[model samples]
Target: MPQFSRHSRRGRVMIAIGLSALLLGTSACTRLRTHQGYQVDKLLVDSVQPGIDNRASVEGTLGRPSFVSQFGEQDWYYVSRNMRALAFSNPKPVEQTVLRVRFDPAGNVAAVDRMGLEQVAHISPSGDKTPTLGRHRSLFDEIFGNIGAVGAAGMGGGSAGGPGGGPNGS
Candidate 1:
């Protein structure tokens, strides 16, 4: 029969506990960095000039935009964000860059604008039920509200219904 001494078994248990605690301690303070969208190169971006650069040249220099304006003035946006998260929590935007390049009718660059985290909006949802403007009713009212709403003919004032039961009430 195989046997383990008391001291050996105690040492194994102590080692296991210590390893588990060490794993958890390291994971608890782990900081994760996530990069999203276009990576900006200062030198390349600075070279793009208004009136001097057209659609073709801009595309060649900076590649395709992250997104184009859907409505109003012709504009291109290159968005970038640096998100940081710890453990399993939601990532928060630590840094953001939104570069807007506007174009004139001739497809030449009109203006260049840069924005940062100051423009980022943080919103908290209002919860499961959307707040709609109307009269509020209880659960019971919603379930039984339609009971006997119409007359015997289904419609408030109808003779009978389909078949011969029409305008003549045959």
Candidate 2:
């Protein structure tokens, strides 16, 4: 059996340690990134009194909202989240917050609300089988179903009277 020299064994150990350190360092470097959208400070939100603040004043104080209500123009939402990912994995949200401000018909701030990650909902599919309409065909049926369908309407190239010619020609 070939035996490793003392120096070679030390070098192998060093290389293994280096590779391990690299892997650990890369994993440790994975950091959570915060994506801020319409950053609404609690103090600033409190500063704006509901009845006193109008749309213009709210925009001037807190800037534009992250999203506006789809059904109406009165509700504005400020959303923020922190997401973390490792290597090729998809980023997952670690923290989230949403601030909703409602405006009255007169374009005045009517109410303010806040929602956290506690309000988040996770939905998963119930099963693997998807319900489909109509009867399912077998593999062979799918492959041969159209074999004779093409020439069913008298569109085949062969003549009626003979193999390759019409009756008058024969």
Q: Which prediction has the highest lDDT against the true structure?
A: 1
Query: Candidates' TM-scores?
Result: 0.79, 0.67
Residue 141, model 1: lDDT of 92
> What lDDT tens digits, residue by residue, belong to model 1 across residues 1-170?
13568778889999999999999999898999999999998888898999899888888988899999999548999999999999888999999999899999989999989999998777888788888899799999999877776544555454456554566655
TM-score, cand. 1: 0.79
Expressed as tens digits, the lDDT of each residue in 56-116 for candidate 2 is 9988888888999999899988898877877567788887889888999999999999898
Deviation from native of the Cα of residue 119 in model 1, angstroms: 1.7
- Model 1 lDDT, full chain set: 0.87
Which runs of model 2 end up more than 4 angstroms from their true locations?
1-29, 138-144, 150-170
Model 2, residue 130: distance off in Å is 3.0
